[model samples]
Target: MPYVEVLAPQVPNQRKAALAKSVTDGLMTAFGVTADTVTLYFLPISPDDYAHAGEFEPQGAGQRILLKVHAFRRTEAERRAAAIALTRGVCSAYGVPGDDVAVYFLDRDRSEVAHDSKLASD
Candidate 1:
């Protein structure tokens, strides 16, 4: 399974559903996971809560989206491909510039993740 967390301040509510679908599809394709095995979470933040370069973001800070992906360990090449897929999916879904979307991947062992009161390794 793979978990994707998206934090953004500029994403419009009307498009969130589409964005989620895009993210799920990208993850499934990139990691060869089933749709039900991929989890997508969106956390919307206010400008007052987000900052860059040690300054609070202004009203027009631009369309910025941050993605954090957690999954099983993989080769560097695989991780790189997944990141590209995620970035393209987000940018295409939200109509944001590619540079405004960033994707970070974290590889974890099965023992490090838990679901439904049980660890993945269990």
Candidate 2:
């Protein structure tokens, strides 16, 4: 299972839908994973609660989105492709600059994950 977490400011439901589709498609294309196996969670952060460089509201500070991708171990090339796809999707749907987004890949072992009351390794 590949789980993706998107942390950024809140947006309209339509934008969320588009982001979900884009990320899912990107994962499928880059990771060879089925749509059903991909999972995404959106976490909205309030603007007031965010600060950068000790500034409450930094001027020209575009939206900073953090994407945490968790999945079974994969090659560096795969991670790079996925990162590019994800960044493109986020920039397109969220209307944010590419420099404003950050992506982190978390590699896991099948035995480290559990689903439906069973370990993924089983």
RMSD of 2: 1.7
Q: Which candidate leads in TM-score?
A: 2
TM-score of 1: 0.84
TM-score per candidate, in order?
0.84, 0.91
Q: What value of lDDT does candidate 2 attain over all alpha carbons?
A: 0.88
Query: What is the C-alpha lDDT profile of model 1 across 1-79, one tens digit per residue?
Result: 7888888765666677777777787777767778898888888777667677777776737647889888998778778
lDDT of each: 0.79, 0.88
| Model 2 Cα lDDT, one tens digit per residue, 60-81 | 3565899999999989888899
Candidate 1 Cα RMSD (Å): 2.0
The reply for model 1, stretches above 4 Å from the true place, is 10-14
The numbered model that scores best in lDDT is: 2
